[model samples]
Target: MGTFITCAVTGGADTVSRHPRIPVTPKEIADAAISAAKAGAAIVHLHARDPKTGQQSRDPELFTEIVSLIRDSDTDVIINVSCGMAGDLILTDTPETQPAGAGTDLLGPRGRLQHLDRLCRDPRLKPEICTLDCGSMNFGDGDLVYLAPATYLRPMAQHIRSLGIKPELEVFELGHLAFVQKMSAEGLLDGAPLIQFCLGIPGGAPAEPFILDAFKQLAPTGSVWSAFAIGRDELRFVSLAAGQGGNVRVGLEDNLYLEKGVFADNDTLVERAVGLIRGMGGSVMNAADTRQKLGLDRAH
Candidate 1:
């Protein structure tokens, strides 16, 4: 089977602290995405951030600027915006002491989709796909928990369905995949659902061969599935997922180094993925075919 590779640019959080060139501004983000598309990525996934402070943001204006720049560049790539921001639940020192600490960014379904809604107003700026974190789980070993309980997901899923845009279900655990499959059965999701297996996270499934095999068994039938792992497992999963009849994702969002201590940019990562896919005897897909396969709306 052919592969659909997506380059996840700068992540959903502050990455400037992690690496020198993490793409904080709109122009930088757009430029990185353009380069990724040229390097053979079918889609470019984006997460907004404050231009000045290099902090993560869900600002519609920021998204507008990024989308506009990408569109104006005449780049032929699918734009996959992120809607993963949640009302953070942070319990400082003790649960009773600081129930909602300084790091907490608690928000409801509507609040999380605010930026997505604003983007839809302009057909040219609308994204073809946006992420939907499948379930609530403790974010890493920290005091924060990324909450996406039934209450939030029910309405949020409905909103995404109404928009008629695809929601790439971000599955951190097997249970998350099971829940989204149920939602699809109930007709809350549109088209052939796209499920992204996100492994190697702190509180979720580790990047192991057996776990990936199990996730494939649990994934919904007739769904477009892609998988990615953080850090070193990132490149390895490319061949593994393709061998298992799934697509793959790669970029700076998951790893900074192209090699041992060698920091790489978004374009470099995309080029590597292209080489890997071709090396595996699988052809890399372009944006137009990817849109047709995933049932995504086109940019005007």
Candidate 2:
């Protein structure tokens, strides 16, 4: 298979104020996805932000607008909506108090998947895949922990399977892959399993060649996987991942810089990845081919 490029156009949460062109509205997000498809991206991962405030949103209507606009356009990229929302945690400073302060957005399985439920029911907007973060960890500094407890994940995995949408397993740490392997062995994941090695997310594995190698080595054999890193390591990981027989994911969602201190849009990042893949004597896969490769057309 050729190197597949998945462009994550916008993230549910981001440092959007730092960059001027982060897409906030449905029209802006759809336009970015269309441009990425034109630039050789096989898949477009989507996240919705409030139109007025630009904060992350779990509103089904926002997703509907973005998916509708993209489908209405000329592009034919596979839509991968983020099902990993409302996991943010911001804790108070007091050592003994242990109170989750202003930024906490944790939700139970059903609450977290409210938008995904709507997507699965909407024939026109149902995504080809949705993210399922395999484990939980300390997000950044003291008291900020991200949770995807097994108690929550097992049921959520079954729900995703029932929806007939592929769950792109997002493994941050090596232990996280254990759950994924378990799910696959138990027949929860249909077709070939799809995995995404999310590197350099504060608490996860660092963005380095050896760490990525370890992830690829430990994943379920024959799983179709893509790997990416955040910020400065983003492009470097692309080159490293290509050599390891993994697909590539790049876009403003992962990194804002096109060059040193220069902001970029989704298309530019994907175009650069296409060039990088071709430079390595590999070609970029188109949307239809990627879907076939990932067995996206298979019934659940």
Candidate 3:
């Protein structure tokens, strides 16, 4: 009945230049995940980056190397690979080029699953869970769009289920949760849906108490849900979520500072989350207990 923490070690955001240390390489990312696990994170969410340029990458090879390192290190943590990459749709003003311009990496549902397909084929590389972004949204206040329509999500969910990987339904806004309910009603999702309320992103839900309360009420009943906000509100949501009978997530991916002007790594962010949950009189769940609770397959 205690809350569990999911540390999103590194996200696909362009945050390398902003933070002194953001885990750009496979080794660094794997090391961050392992360290966070040691610091009491039950799950480590991951996103790969281009080693040479430090740009976000959906390359299966990078993921292969990253997961191999984690599994080889004998770390006991749930691996949740992000399937939310390659969905950027940057709008172009040029009439000739039309919709997509530079930085557009849109792909079909199956195309987006290329990395998962490669990883799941190898028993040793298959992660315990993978994310399924439930809807499309403006990436920010810019021309970029994170496109993942219902058509794309249905097949993606079905495919993730087929791979025997638990799907973490990431809802960025209230409307997205409605789609989750629909997907659940249609049986696209397996087991009690694992939901993550992603707040504080521009053009998405704001990281506020009233909004979080609304999300909690609107989320599907019986869902194993966690909530997080970006930047300053990241750790604050940890306290909010646990106080409301929900799990929490925190890491450098969401926030880069332990406090004002202080850089934070994955482990410290997780350690802070542990303190918050424990101080609230809530126990923390380990990787094994998390798997059982989420109905995930045994770790390979």
Candidate 4:
């Protein structure tokens, strides 16, 4: 099958101020996703934010509204909401006083999946795929961490599978990939598991070609995989991923620039990726073809 693109429209990053137009409101995010689909993205990976404050939120209603907006539209882009929220753990100098500091938004598995649960009540609003962060890691500099231990992840994966949603295994490093393999061995994942190699984060694996080659080699056989790198390396990895016979992802979530000193929106990033893929002599798969390739259920 040909390569497909997944556009991560807006994330929990502090990019709203960095760029002129970051999709913060539910309508804006939905519009960005739809526009990206029109620009040749097969899937639109999404996250919800507070409309007024432009801050990150895990509120199920916000997600429901966003999904509703997208589904109501004519676009048939595959929806993939993040289950990676509410997992941040910030440390304090006085460990006893503040184990999880002010920035921390840590929650157990159920709280993390609440948004997906809310959307699942209506088949039409249910996302075709949701993310499952394979393991925990130090997110960036400072004491902040992205906490997703195996104990929490196992149950989260089970719940995601039970909901009839494909879990995109997001791995930041080799250890995370190992945990994913362990889950697959325990019969937690269904069908050919979808994996996403997330590289070039401050505390994660470097976004180097050799690193991607290693990840591709270690990944489970027959698993459908895609990859992305944050910031400047985002576009570079698009070509690298496509050239290596895998899928590609691009959007303002992971990058804010179409080029140096040039701010970008979701649609432009997807369009640039489409150009890169076609430039590499690769066929860009549409949403229907990607659904078939990934075995996504579209009964809704």
- List, in order, the clash count of every candidate structure: 4, 0, 0, 0
* Model 2 lDDT per residue over 159-241, tens place: 98888889999999999988889988988888889999999988788898888888888889889999999998899888989
**Candidate 3 — worst ten consecutive residues by lDDT sum?**
94-103
Against the unseen true structure, what C-alpha lDDT does each candidate score? 0.89, 0.88, 0.93, 0.93
Query: Model 1 Cα displacement at 276 (Å)?
Result: 0.7
Could you give the candidate ranking by TM-score, starting with the highest?
Answer: 4, 3, 1, 2
Indicate the worst ten consecutive residues by lDDT in candidate 1. 91-100
Q: List the lowest-lDDT window of 10 residues for candidate 2.
A: 291-300
Clashing pairs in 1: 87-105, 87-106, 87-107, 88-105
- Backbone clashes in candidate 2 total 0
Candidate 2 C-alpha error for residue 87, in Å: 2.0
Off by over 4 Å in 1: none
Which regions in candidate 2 have their CA more than 4 angstroms from the true location? Answer: 298-300
Decreasing lDDT order of the candidates: 4, 3, 1, 2
TM-score of each: 0.97, 0.96, 0.98, 0.99
- Best-fitting candidate, scored by TM-score: 4
Whose lDDT is greatest here?
Answer: 4
lDDT of 3 by residue, 1-300 (tens): 689899999898889999999999999999999999999999999999999999889999999999999999999999999999878888988847597888889889999999999998889999999999999999778889898999899999999999999999999999999999999999998889899999999999999999989988888889989999999999999999999989999998899999998999999999999999999889999998988899888648
Candidates 2 and 4 compared by lDDT, better number? 4
Clashing pairs in 2: none
Whichever of 1 and 3 has more TM-score, that candidate is 3
**lDDT at position 73, candidate 2:** 81
Off by over 4 Å in 3: 95-97
Better of 1 and 4 by TM-score: 4
Per-model C-alpha RMSD: 1.1, 1.7, 1.0, 0.8
